[model samples]
Target: MKIRVTGAFLFNVLCTISYTCCGETVGKRPPHIVMIIADDMGSNDLSYRGLDQITTANLDAMGFNGIIFNRHYTEPICTPSRAALLTGQYPIRLGLQGEPISAGEDRHLPPDVQTLPQLLKELGYTTHLVGKWHLGTARREDIPKGRGFDTHYGYWNGYIGYFDYETKSAMTITSEVYEGFDMKENFVDAWKDKGIYATHIFTEKALDIIDAQNKDIPMFLMVGHLAVHTGKNGMVEVADEKTMNNTYGYIADLERRRYVDALMNLDDSVGRIVEKLQQRDLLQNSVVIFMSDNGAQIRGIFHNGGSNYPLRGEKFSHHDGGIKNAALLYSPLLEKKNYIHDHLIHITDWLPTLYSLAGGNITSLKKTDGVDQWLSISQNKPSKRKNILINIDEVKLYSGVIGYGGRYKLLNGTIQSGFYDSFTGEPQSSNKMDYDIAAILNSRVNKAIKKSKVPGKHLDEALIRNLRKSSSAIRNNSKCNRGTEKYEICHHFCLFDLWTDPCETENLIRQKSKDDIVLNLKNQLAEFWNEVSPQTNKPVDINSDPAKYNGTWCTWLDDEFCIKIKTNNQNKNCNENNRSTSSIPVLKL
Candidate 1:
């Protein structure tokens, strides 16, 4: 990997921040980018986006002034989208096609992949991450500090008992007893070991990172808050049993209100981070982007109420509600208004865009999977982003046979996690045209996946075969899948025509003539499949028995890896008498 540095040209490292464009020579002041991401703020829940119930004043103000992208797309889940956002390519492209992060493994992003933080770090900017890092965990090497981030302060795993904050940094890692992550470093241990609420501490660390810096270079701070992602321990009652207090409308989701309270507090942290920048006279020269990793977790209908209302679907499914997050970008470089860009942009595109905005030499870097789109956003240019995004269970279907093109998305036959238009409030649905499109989206995605394939691992094709083995009498005939697939409830393959029917009420799978659309899409899918043949490498089959695909079996946290626990721990099973029993459902791709 050749290191290219032409830093003196194209960027003026000395201009003070400004308010309003004021013809501010942005090129001279190359803005400091601060990407703030909320864990699970819903698509229609933010006040700026037209949600009446919740008030995201900070985000709304940012949207009111800067550019609000109306058509942002992710994997409708956490880990994949976050990976895609940082990589500037499809999560599938990088083998991160399933779940938020890997189950029971310290699944670091592949070493060869391009990461936004790494790119910025190489470009001479101080990079930092503070908050949930569901992307990878379980090992010291898998921590964020190792992944281009110069500093980090947050939990390595998903959750902890009441009142806790844990941290791992480039210099030191404070360990606590956590069930999922660094068992040595629990928030309670952080609370017990070092009185800190992970959120507030991270905020302070982020602010401190900004303050303790000298004027040697600019900064790129990514505050990926983990609040609101959990059911409600921070703001409201979270556990079902805790809802006995019964103060809110729906008491079952106490975890949700606590989640909201935690979120509200996080907003204050955002305000503080912004204020620090302003105080340093850098806000004017900084670009602030706020959004969630994915849609709301559907704990209870209104528990967290991470509303995807006008859109459809929730976490775990690839519906609009799941993938289309509410995003706002603020910069003096951008105009002040409720400007919305409906162009289709996914998380990965940010890789190149961030580089372009930072004026980095991306062309000479082999790890990048992004496209520079700053000029496009500033000039209102059309999107040239990928048309398709596909993730074959446990495999990233990007590049080779499964890459993205334009105006299309491809996917394996695993289509239950759907796509739709719940982006706005609830739909009125007289628009039969959109409904018509909704009916065909699944087939379209499947077709897209089939056509996007160019070469490399053929795990997706094998996973598709495994799905057909669910009802088989014996497990031996199933695809030689190394692990069992995870299955959610009746999260059936759904469709919606955002161009016409956004509600996604009228399912098109049963439609008689829908076969034509399905067939057309399947053919397109085949094109991509042949394009990226797993045969090139003679990829060894993991499963030869299509009948052995036992994804329906349950386990903790909807993670497929947990399924093997039952088989592995034949002596130890979920028992009421024993406390080792876990309630989390195993979800496999």
Candidate 2:
């Protein structure tokens, strides 16, 4: 006799199958995830990467003990990179691949997309955001709280003043600048935090959350630091005056010295957070991630004196220096550690990777450009990803299209008026002051390693020396012969073997042997561009100006005049054929 199968029985069978595919056994407690993101950090800014100008002992320790993703990539700018991380899909799919969201613009991450935090929340995790939320804020549903974060304690716009917590935007029509307080604590003005430095305040809030978190339920905390990014006036903010003047006084460039101070404060925040995790007994069951949103802006808007030396291009370009970033993962759950992973990985892979690690069903997620790399990351297996569509932007001028497959990368456009096509940043120089890496290992690394209970491993001077040697070997092997040319132009098309010429130093379009590779990558780029969504960027809304909202940048779509202005703009666009463009009315004081 045949057994009857009902819908409920089929659903149960599918769930079991999906769970098995997730690579995690049922009934196991999911690991806590703590993600720390730095804004506008350079590719070679860290001390562990052989940059002798600045020291990042805490971050260096993490790299020394964790898996360093040498080929990890992100978008060339802030909004796109954050969108890819949160949704596990390319920003082009959500129309966010254009320029970053301005203070009063109407663009934001689409409301219907399920975010990483939302998925974790379904698996019994408490999600919190403790820093920048640059996706969107024009609508109430676009804020962090509305997008699955249980609580948000930071600024809603892009970068803000470290001490004053203010955002300034100039009107499109008249170029009139408007300034306002941008900090908020879960949808209200956090005026009390105005005078406090952002890094210190954000770190304290994270520590508090960790201290008060429920032990039974898993937690997901994201610390989006404002360090290394320039303040409201396009100047680097110094966190410690004495440190800059005395410790880093040897650096002739004052701007670079200020930036180094800011980075040190960020490093201090990392150390404190890790120490808290160990104290709270969360170290053994937690996965910690540290990364930058994108490459640094060496010279431009929001310039912070950052350097991506030895790599070409800056923040807004598609070059390796612009999109390639330094990232590492640390946890006791990994079977692999202390090695540089050279396989290709993209920012979009985090959504499915993290979800699978959280014991969620990956088959349930909608069609995404990202693929699960949990096994590849945790088990040291070869990456399942073969190609990455860097970006395809049609709205912004000089914004290019890029694609990577196998060992080759293709680019068809330029960025920043093609001014940053060469290597940018400070010259490689010797250290003026010596820092003790052994002290950090003894004080910070050994304690955490002992608590983590991973067997047969001890961090010491020999281990660190070995790690530095291996890392240097990887870096040296990837370097190609630098061309004597001053600048490499890519106005039409350019091809380079990323495995050999990681710096984009030589364009191989002239080689006859690489025709097949170039054609294949070009075809892939075309397919990605075909699925591009119309960019959602809108003109600056003067009605959303902070001057009208009690001197704070806020959601103004609820106000009567704001709604009326939106309607008026819509009507004006509809009747443009009968009216002159200059007839539009300006905002009245």
Across 1-589, the per-residue lDDT of candidate 2 in tens digits comes to: 9997543344345334533435445223667899999999988887777676766788878877778888889998999999999999898899998888989888888878889998888777889999999998887788898898999999998899887778888777899888877888887777666667789889999999999887656789999999889988678787657757897877777888888888988988988888888888887778899999888888776778787767788888888888889898888877777777777789999999888787767898985778898777777777888888888888653333344434788888786557666776444433554545665575454466667676546667777777766654535644533445445688878887777777777888879898887788878888887888988888778878875665678887756423222354554453343223223231111
Candidate 2 residue runs with Cα over 4 Å from true position:
1-21, 24-27, 397-406, 425-435, 443-446, 474-484, 560-589
lDDT of each: 0.50, 0.78
lDDT over C-alpha atoms for residue 475 of model 1: 19
Indicate the worst ten consecutive residues by lDDT in candidate 2: 580-589
Residues 90-139, model 1: lDDT tens digits: 65455566644422334556667767887777656777776666655433
Cand. 1 Cα-lDDT: 0.50
lDDT score at residue 75, model 1, on the 0-100 scale: 67
Question: Candidate 2, TM-score vs. the true structure?
Answer: 0.89
Candidate 1's displacement at residue 326, Å, is: 0.5
